[model samples]
Target: MQIVEDDIRVDELCTRREYARWLVRLNSLLERNPKHRIVPTISLSGSLAVAFDDISVDDPDFVYIQALAEAGIIPSKLSSTSLFSVTPEDGSFYFNPDRYLSRKDMINWRAQLEYAILPGTKEQMSRIRADYMDVKDISSDTSPEFFADMLTGEKSIIRKVFGQSRRFQPNKPSTKAQAAVTLTSGRMAEAVQHELLRMEAESSSRQAAAEEIKSELLVRGDIKNFWNEKLLVERNRGVEVQKLYIATLQDLDKEKNLQAQNLTENMKEKAAMDCQRHLILTLREEIEETSERLASERATYVAEQCNIQELRKAALMDQEGILDSKSILEAEVEALRILRTWVEDEAKKSQARAKVLEEVGRRWKWDNQA
Candidate 1:
């Protein structure tokens, strides 16, 4: 169990005083909770190389150092020469255990804590074994798996402390303030991780909601298109109906025109038939009159022919009578001629006789005179 020391300035330099307080608190917690005895043990040197004359078991700083080493946070190989080494020329070597912890040391310690907290699975052990091989200058007696458990796991506590790179400059010391901050950061990593997970869950929910909304919109659009198509079909039907209505009207008009034409033709035919009837009646009457006239003329011609025959007979009778009269007149003329001839003959005879008498009388007178 890691101790969360109250009154410790986690953002300031971690002084020896703060380390002592933290250690004391850790011991108290361990005493109170016997079940938290799972803290890993660290290998410590059997003896210190430099003999510090002033150092004793009751020394708070020395005790705190020992406590950290036991908890595997600090290595037992902490160089004590700097704390207890005497100057070559002077005997005035002051004891100052208030040295601030280093950033590197704190990171190392944090890595240890993280490794201890990891579950000891077979895969974890194998991975740690592999990881430890990559670490330079590993101790000869250190088990790779055990060393891995004291170093780091997948969640590198070192990275959270140092930012970005997890390079452990093991020898590089840390400021007391930086060490305090590193410790506090390790404790806070869990909360931050949980918050990130929560945010991701919210984002996923939002994405799901957006997809649902898009599907709904698509459905609505399809419905709208369906309605529009129906409307278009209805509109086309109306246009077709109008076309049919107009065609019906035009057909009716054509029928009416045809009927009127038929009526006019019938009337013309009736008029023609009436005129023909009148002409036939007139011709019939004329033919009757002509037939009657021909009959009358035939009768007149027959009578005239009879009269002409009678006239011809009368002329023949006249001619015969005239011929008879001429014959009678010629007979009379012949008779007259004969009578004149007789008369002339008688007259000539008488004149001859008288002459003879006159001749004889002259003779007689001559005789008397003689």
Candidate 2:
């Protein structure tokens, strides 16, 4: 961390990087432990505001307080700063007495400033420096030379201080362009702002004239009666309007009821339509079943007709065969007659055998029997 030896002394200049780093560090330290913007003599705790305005700087109480503060006896909050430093979400920075003060007391701030003594006595100036630099009283020989001795002595470490380097090609190239744009934008808005201001001025004047007229009217006692009468008229009109509103609501209710009735009728019609549709569907199904039955019956009838035709054809073929062969038909008839005659002959033989009491019956040789 040590940059130089204790025994050695150099007159070489420090780099800008070192300076910048130290500067940034100092800024960070300040941010971490913020310094007071001002140290006030007055403090407010809740509703209670404690002020040192009653005591003058020459007073024993004021001197005693400063002594105690120097001795670290009095608290910094009570001795120097306010109870609170309100900023951002911290409320107002300046002291505003408007919260507790009345309209009559708002302008009366001279009382608080009655004992407002400017601290630290000023040394009489022998001559004024052209650059407004005050004559610094450097008394101690052992005291560190803050500026003059360090810059002038042969043991001076800083030989030169340089300004910012040429930034022809800057780190942020768009910065210049953006700054130009911002400036141009402001210039562009100037005319509009001027016009707006002129319009606002005219409006303000008109408002002021209206306010003046209103203020003048405040002197008239009759205006109160006029407003009261107007108010009464407005209230009566309001009552009539309310009655009309109620009548409108009643009409709306009636309309709703009518709509409801219509809706009910529509629902009934819809229900009837649905029932009719269902019945139509049922009838369609029945018709389809009947049609299917009829189709089956027709097929059966056609099938039966086909079978009857086949049977009739068979009958006609047999008749045709009989017509074609008439001799064969006569032969079959004669054979059937012979078979009947044989049965009759058997009956006669049985009777004859019965008459003889032991006669044997004769069988025909039709069975190939001998």
Candidate 3:
């Protein structure tokens, strides 16, 4: 069946009247062609199908007609703007023409078709069969009678076939406001899930860093303590040497004085006294050497102590810095953990709300239709 030239150009935007006219024309055409055996089928690939009840002036219904044309169920051609299909040997239908189009456009159209067919119930199916039987015997398939019968039959049959295929679940029937709420809630839950995962990762990283810092600080402290102890031992050794030298000098002076007094009575004793003086001078030299050595040793000990103290101070400062850093990191980790918890809670609430909204929408739709 050929579409009349006048009916060829449907309005770019679909209106209720325009839709009715297109349906009528299409039904007439199908009825005249026995090979086509076209029957109206619900589809959800047009703008009108997506937003059926709330369709704006710009929305168009995306529909498919079931036909035995070429031994397969295929969509009917409506206009140049209507989407076309790609034939696959696997017998699966595809909207290949719309592959390049925006997803929103595709989804809206598909939804519109779904909404249109959802209203048809079982009672409408019986009427469609009766109508088809009335026109089954017409020999001249192109007659006005054939066209009328096809339109009536096809419309009834298409309208009566309700429910979606198991594969294509309809959006929950709800007010636009309710649908919006459900979408927002779902998104919020998804965002929260992502945030929680991020927080968990961050917390783990912070703990690892803190442990590394603490270990480094402990090593530094141990080295500082070792150096400080070494300095103290060296300083004590210097003090002991100084005391021993002083006691030896005092003993040598007493022995020299006693020898001088005894030798004062004779010339030989005088020579002996001179020798004793030389010995006393040698003892003084020894004492001076010992004092100088002790002073040098004491200076070395002080330098060592100074160096050790400086090292200790630096190590302590580093330890303090590490401790501070650890504290800050711990606090940040805690904050993130808290935030993660809050996000998870919010996600749960949002998910629950979305479920409730969807259930309510389904109930309301059923009641309204009833």
Measured by TM-score, the strongest candidate is: 1
TM-score of each: 0.29, 0.29, 0.24
Q: Number of backbone collisions per candidate, in order?
A: 7, 0, 13
Worst 10 residues of 1 by lDDT: 35-44
Q: List candidate 3 segments past 4 Å from native.
A: 1-280, 361-370
Q: Estimate, for each residue in 1-370, the C-alpha lDDT of model 2 and write its tens digit.
A: 1212344223332222222222222222221222211112321113132223333455433432332233222223233334223222432222121122121111111111111213331111122221112213321221122222122333221111111222111111122222222212212235335656877999999999998877777777556877999999999999999999999999999999999999999999999999999999999999999999999999999999999999999999998898868878788889988988997899898878786654323233333466
Residue 196 miss distance in model 3 (angstroms): 99
Superposed Cα deviation of residue 101, candidate 1 (Å): 3.0
How many clashing residue pairs, candidate 3?
13
Angstrom error at residue 206, model 3: 99
Q: How does each model score on lDDT?
A: 0.58, 0.41, 0.45
Better of 1 and 3 by lDDT: 1
Candidate 2 residue pairs in clash (backbone atoms < 3 Å):
none
Candidate numbers, best TM-score first, in rank order: 1, 2, 3
For each of the candidates, the C-alpha root-mean-square deviation to the true structure, in angstroms, is 46.2, 29.7, 57.6
